[model samples]
Target: MLFEDPVFASRMLSLLTLSIHAIFATLGVGLPLMIIIAHWLGIKKNDEHYLLMARRWARGFVVLVAVGVVTGTAIALQLALLWPNFMEMAGHVIALPLFMEVFAFFFEAIFLGIYLYTWNRFDDQRKHLLLLIPVAIGATMSAFFITTVNGFMNAPTGFQIIGGQMTGVSPIEAMFNPATPTKAAHVISTAFMTSAFVLAALAAYRLLKGAQHVYYKKALHLMMVVGLIFAIATAVIGDFAGKYLAKHQPEKLAAAEWHFETMEGAPLVLFGILDDEQNVRFGLEIPYALSILAHNHPQAEVIGLNEFPQEWHPPLFIHYLFDLMVIIGVWLVLFSFVYWWGMRRKWTIVTSRWFRRLIVASGPLAMLAIQAGWWMTEFGRQPWILRGVMTVEEAATQSPYVGHLFFFFLALYLILVIGVVVVLRNINQRFPLEQDLAHEGGERPWIT
Candidate 1:
């Protein structure tokens, strides 16, 4: 017989899977653009070092893609088994994107194989680079379609729930819901930003370990530029996301800001602890900042938690997730900006051992920020699996097996992580940077 109290177990299992899957999925979405650019640069400059960077990144990306596919499949299964009610209802109005995502995944997979194996088949490296265009497109589209489903959950438009049945369904409207553009853009931009920093961290570590090479410098510089561009885009889109919350999901916005009273000229709370009584403690209070962020006007009215029932309020701790994401976004902007400027000024500080340590640290921090942002989004929508439509309790599976399944998947993720580390370490050992450089003047078997 199925257990009735499986909501918590199911929720935890899904959270664990998504969190682990995030690492590989983020790279799958972002690494292709970088690979294509690096390959293009290699061809343009006729530089063996750049070619080596592209080849190395591509090989590692293949491993990530494999693991990502496995975890992605796990997510797919969990959606049907764990949230059958939500899917059954959503399948009527929001199934288009979910169906399209499968095609997108295959498109990406097909081109990735072609790109990987045909590295040296064409005389023109540019022609080889051309194959990655489809790969990038497929990866980007996959993220786009999946995010649209998330967007629909947030907005829940395109259909009417009449007598507990969906009516007036329009899949197109659900796909083009108000939340899709900002959410999709933000997800893509941050994925690119996080991936760049992770790769840049590798280069920084190389330099820190006394690996004296111009290749690391070039690699770091390229990633810094890419990181800077996308980081700025993330901030801009994040602002739009704020505006979206204020207009469409005011309760979530209110909870994230610790706004307890609905009023104009609201203050923004920064890094505060919520007391047992729900009061802000030790927070930096910026007068009218919340109003401005929500409505582009300092005097505009901002909603608050009091506007909804106590049960409707999301956890107050999510404010920390919101703050962490903002802080990290700003930090990366400053870090990448200063690095790029320092290079232009030819300052020794830019290449200092301590500075490289900071660079190595930034990569993990960027990913940490990504997790915080995603958590903030998911947690802010508390109680409701689809805002105003279905509660999590209503959507979660009644199966007792969820608890056991969580442990099983947790072990699977650990094994996958160990396998990836072993494979990547072996690849690095088998084809060291110095070894590749030594053979640059001769026939390059590494190309195959």
Candidate 2:
């Protein structure tokens, strides 16, 4: 068990790195894309307010992206140090995407810098707007490459073991591996979904406080539209992604569905306690829904956790994560509908005290959705390091010092969190958007 102790430590280290990485991932993908889209619209319509909004958001995004890059680099380095066997075996297959991710990072930084400093240096509006294309593309490509690597992990491909050694690794095959496409699409959509909800929540807060300036209203409307669009898209794609997982990773689907055995026309446990020893759900159930969802048949049989030995069972913690994600997603969809309907009738919901309460709650809900979504992805794989080839324990750092990495990252993230709060406070204090625009700069471009 002493040797196995390091395995747990290694997992905790990776989780720390992953959790930090998730923050960056959310900001890196979500903030930049939103700003870029806003910037594009700004340039197209000659709307100075839109451009100003874009610049402010981009400034915040730049600061966050800097931290994101630092945390991401740390994660990549730790991956090699902690999972040497996994790296040595699968690194070659993922080399191309990893290399592309680096390029994406550099390219995004380059354009972002130029755009930050080149407003006066470049007189042509069209040329200036062109700079954003690369910035947007680079940010998106960075996320896409990382998602591809993650996807490959879920459904590995592009290599073989010959005489106990992985050989003939193919990058192309790995990029198009079994789970890569669907997983990438799912993650990409979730990023947008979480971002929209977060932005909407912020805008809703402002709207509720009677900050009815033109700029704030515009921002709120934009956020609402974005939230509605991404919410609907996420629902459709999530369904597709779920069906894909059901076909390929049935055990994971079973765990998420909370099914305890092979059963006919399984009742879906919407909210329940899994009695693993007794192999039954001990709470609320929706009759025959699981069978219909998983197999499109009312009486279709679904396998469950009891079919696998206790040692091989996926962690119950992970099953809870899956449930949390699904529940939050459904909540988002419902809230989005309410918001959209209220907006059509002149934002009656935002002015109401009850809606303001809900708006405040949505901030944490959005964050929980992001964390839960990732938890499901990483934890649902369960024992697999490569989904059919290796176990999590087998792929972990064999070294005793792995726990140090976890503590190091915990301290680092605490510092980063403090820094983020300080920066946000300073921005709000110095340039309070709720106040009159004349007090700031008389509609001139002011970067926060």
Candidate 3:
């Protein structure tokens, strides 16, 4: 990275920071809702399995929340430190949401601490369950507020530049930028989808390891149900994302589809290689798909990369990132459908060891899909750090220590990851299922 162009090195380091932070951020936002729902079900159904399930999830989440706090803090600082110029402008118009997110984070942290220690402290289960609502709301609002800043970047509104200063600022308008709803909803749904699958993967691994207990079965069922619901929601919101891009950020939509020429009925190119001749080679083209994606009409005229100068054009390689994201989304949908069908039909194949292993694999694959979507979004905005308002070169910090800072943060993230794994493993070992089962006076390690 030191040998690379300074601007390019800074961009790569920012990408690394965001990529790592996203892992915990995704879980942090999604898991609170899951935990609360699981707890609610435990009381409603009078089921001890769900009661233990929720408790276990909550215990593991404490560690993740701490990691999220550290990474979240690191990212907040990195924005100002690495992109001083952009932050300078943003501090005037978009600062409201950024500041609001801190309050939201504190809200979440306070309730989470209360929720953890107060577990099983209430005779009225509903009273204890009520405590989780703020935790869930705070987690979601934290993501929402932060995404508003990003939405402002994509479609910068409620402010203007005059005499090299941002003027006419309206923080509310900027916070609710055109891209905010779609992007925020998309982020949230995918986070839920990814988190569900990750927990499902853990349950599947347990089931595959010959733990045929009803506890594991119940856990797997809950995660899969949640995964399937959010998977569908993610797909629906993704379509809205396409429409949003086509209308406001058409160049991004065009590049993702590899549509080079502006025309009606433009075919959507999937998995294509671009040649110097401006032709896409050896990839599938779904006729009129791009037009339909853009306008919900097959004959709608869609914008294309040809409309923009080559220098202004985003790198064509982001098309693959777009493709990877879509392909993984489709895979999760279909894979979940099969799991649903097999469960209904009582198919032995779905219960086979290989099928359970597939469930385990889906967890990481879902996370990768998330990574792909984010990369495509950031890369597609290339040349511009804030769309048309600012370029990356202008926004990057001129600090001489960017390389050193990158290494320090990189080492910190590595240590944090190792700590999370070791701590979670220890938690799991310390609170084995037999301890939970002992309270119920049920057969310990009983097979279903």
Best by lDDT: 1
lDDT of 3 by residue, 193-293 (tens): 99899999999999888887889888887888899999999998999999999998988888888887889988888997788888888999899988887
Per-residue CA lDDT of model 1 for 331-365, tens digit only, reads: 99998999999999999998888899999999999
Residue pairs in candidate 1 whose N, alpha carbon or C atoms collide under 3 angstroms: none
lDDT for predicted candidate 2 compared with the true structure? 0.75
TM-score versus the correct structure, for each prediction: 0.97, 0.91, 0.96
Model 2 is weakest, by summed lDDT over 10 consecutive residues, at: 439-448
Please give the CA lDDT of all the candidate structures: 0.90, 0.75, 0.87
lDDT of 2 by residue, 201-269 (tens): 776677777776677667656766676677777777777777677677777777777777788988877
TM-score winner between 1 and 2, please give it: 1
Q: Where is model 2 more than 4 Å wrong at Cα?
A: 1-4, 43-46, 121-126, 207-212, 296-300, 309-311, 434-436, 439-448
Model 3 pairs whose backbones collide:
none
Give the CA lDDT, 0 to 100, for residue 339 in model 3.
93
Candidate 2's displacement at residue 211, Å, is 3.7
